[model samples]
Target chain A: MTEIKFWRGFFSILLVISLLFFIFHVWAVILPFAFGIIIAYLVNPLVDNLAAMGLKRSRVVLILYLILLGAGIMLAMTLIPSLIKEANAAVKELPAYTTAIDDLITKANGEIQKFIKPIFKSKSDVIAIPFAAQKFIDSLIPQLPQKILGVAHAGLWIIIIPFVSFFALSHGKSWIDIIFDSTPSEYVENLLGFMAELNATLGGYVRGLIIESLCVGLLTIAGLWAMGIKGAVLLGVITGLVNFVPFMAPLLGGGLALLTAYFQFKSFSVLVGIALLFIGVRLFDDFVLIPFVVGSSVHLHPVIMVFAILAGVEVAGFIGLVFAIPVAVVIKVFLSVALRHRKERLMFRHEHVYS
Target chain B: MNLSFYRLIKKLFNDENHGEEMSFLRGVPIFFGLSSHQLGRIMQAIQKRKYYAGEILFQEGQIGKAVFIIKTGRVELVKNVPEGGEPRLLGNLGPGQIFGEMALLEHRPRTASARVVEDGEIFLLYTATLEALLKNHPAIGVKLMRNIAVMLSALLRRTNQELENQKKS
Candidate 1:
């Protein structure tokens, strides 16, 4: 019996290792599939409502697809061109930005040298820190193709996402039922309770965050444009997309905006204005948007949330960073449910023994 | 041209399999006073599951998140066992009858255990899904809440009469 148990544990570990290996290798495919799942999850409630109105699931899916297609076309026609134009402009302005940044660094170094020269007896004794800006550029130049390839891969998956999501939304009920059906009868009720809790919390949180990100992105674009900031559109998109990452995203966005504003106008007031805009946006997000839109779904500690995000970045780069918080919530909820079940079982056993 | 357009629209919205599910939902009492359209909406939130005889659906004191409706099954609603005694069978539920209903109304533990007496299918109306539906369609939420109130009142009246009879005896 001990040997049997040992083998069971060993095989379980083996199985887990193999699964992780599979996930690691197929992350490229997995990312698109994960996106599809997210889309399906977000759209499912709407689909269910439509289906409840006597519309066939297939027909409802088709209608959703058509609506999505129309929206995509509209975006392609209107937003895409402007976004592309801005992106190209940003790319063209990159060299000048880098040069300015280099010059700024050099000026700061000279000032530091002047300040420290008095402390040192000889000029050679003072450490002359040289900025390796060229090395940074050279490294980035080689990685440029890989980054473009990644973007192209993402673009391809964007086309496939709708199809995957359509099927997921249409058959979501049956799929959930199928999964629950396979569980042992004794644990089914407990599992269902867990799933319902997960659905309510995680699903609502994700949908809310996506909407929040879009709102932040749009607000950034409009604010920057009104201020006549260069690459406003591109900066806005970056800000909005990054806004999903919580504290890190806003800081990154604000820092980029400040740097750009400093480079372009080179005025302290403009930089301060840009900073104030982000501060206002953050205030609005915290007070109004998060309350109305996101609610208090993600009950994570700030320290834990930051740690998970850093770990995620280490593991899977950008995608990891994006999904870290939601994944942590899922794990936390699942463990809590399991612990509750174990406690209940132990209590039951104790009661039976007393009886 | 009109006929083609009508056909296209029909093909767009109609599902043949929805008929059985729709009819089943219409019969559930909590779902009473709801229109066919409303019933169809409730149907979306319901999940159907099959259980064999002697399988426990839920245990007494276990937290319930969904109300179960018997679609094609017999379920024994049992009270908790006394020390060194068998579980007291409260009643059996057949097709169209519902149990674990307070699960839909509130987040609370089950007062009685539900165990399958025969191999059959049951539909579950999860509270979260129902909450989502209510949020989206306030009218349906109002109707369902009213149904639950009425059902509870009737149950209380019956229990009161039973208690009064016992007192007289």
Candidate 2:
């Protein structure tokens, strides 16, 4: 019996490692299906509710897709033209903004050298700082076309996502049921408990994130537009997209908005106003949106959360960063459940021996 | 177009006997007072499975995580004897009877082992799923908990009587 258990454990570990290896190797191909599964998971409760009302699952999914398609078209019609115009204007004014930034950097470099002269022995060391900064900016411009092409390629997957999600929503439950049927009855209850816990944690986090991002994005658009900032819609959408990663929204979104405001108006007051708007939005998000919307879905320590985000970026770039917290939550739940089960088994054995 | 759409949907996704299932669930003691709408919500959380005769649903001393409702089967609850004697038969449960219900209230070792006496289908409701349902729909939760409390109180009274009779004899 002990030998059987040992082999079972070993094989289970081997299977899991093989699965992870397969996923890692085919990540690019799996991206769309992964996104579809996520979307299906998020929208499942509504589908289940309607299905419970006697509607067929496939029918419900089809109806939902139609509604979403209609909404998406309406939104695009309203928002796309203004966004394109703003983007075009920004591209046209890029050279002038670059010159202005260069001038500002030179002025700042002079002040920086004056302050650090007493500490540094040579002027060359001080000049190196601004030179490296300029070199970095120059390097990024050349890579813009490649990055844009990558984004466009990813955009093609948007069509495939809904197609994949439709089947997933309709057939996902039966797929789970098949697994349940195959599992030994002894471990079925444990599997059900694990799945239930996972559903609660991941479902709450994903739904809460969408709502929070939407609220933050709308607030940003309103604030920037009120202040007559250029490209308010474009900047707000980017903010919402990057809000998937913690702290990226404010840093990237706010920085871009500040630069735009400075270039467009060239007023210190306008720059300060843009800065204040971002600060206010961040404060609101931390105090109100997070507590009310996200609540306690994720309970990782702040340090661990930051580490997970960094590790995610290191592993899979932006996609990894987006999935980091959910993946961490799954690992935490799996370990806790396995450990608890082991402890219970040991305690049971101990009681039996005593008896 | 509407008729064709309906026909296409019906052809693509065949309808199940949801009405029959809902009526069956409505007869269960815990769900006795629930309306069709509330019962529909519960149906979403419950998992149905078929068991063969002589299959062990769960063993005594194992931690219970889900409550099982016999939809169409005979189940026998047995207790293991400590002195290496034959196991004692606790009771025979039939269709509409629930077992492992204590799991819904708390996570503890099951007091008796449940085995299927006849081939039939059963519905399993995990405690976490029930908790989610209760949290989302408090009205159903209140009704279900009240029925469970009433059933438990009756069981306690019966057990007390049994103990008194044993003492008198």
Q: Highest lDDT: give the candidate number.
A: 2
- Model 1 pairs whose backbones collide: A52-B40, A52-B41
The window of 10 residues in a row where model 1 chain A has the poorest summed lDDT is A346-355
Q: What are the interface RMSDs of all the models?
A: 4.0, 3.3
Error of 2 at A213 (Å): 1.5
lDDT of 1 by residue, B26-50 (tens): 8888998898888887776677789
Tens digits of lDDT, candidate 2, A16-62:
99999999899878889988988898899998888777677877898
lDDT for A180 (candidate 2): 84
* Model 1 per-residue lDDT tens digits across residues A1-355: 9999999999999999999999989977887888887899898878877776777887788878899899989988977888899789877888887788787878887888788888874763356656655567867898999999998987899788887888888787779888988888767766776676667657777788888888988899899999999778778888887776777556988998998899888899999899999998898899988999988556778898899899889878977887788778777777776786577656554332111
Clashes of 2: 0
Steric overlap count per candidate:
2, 0
Evaluate residue A293 in candidate 1 and report its C-alpha lDDT on the 0 to 100 scale: 91
Superposed by TM-score, candidate 1 places the C-alpha of residue B19 at a distance from the truth, in angstroms, of: 4.9
Clashes of 1: 2
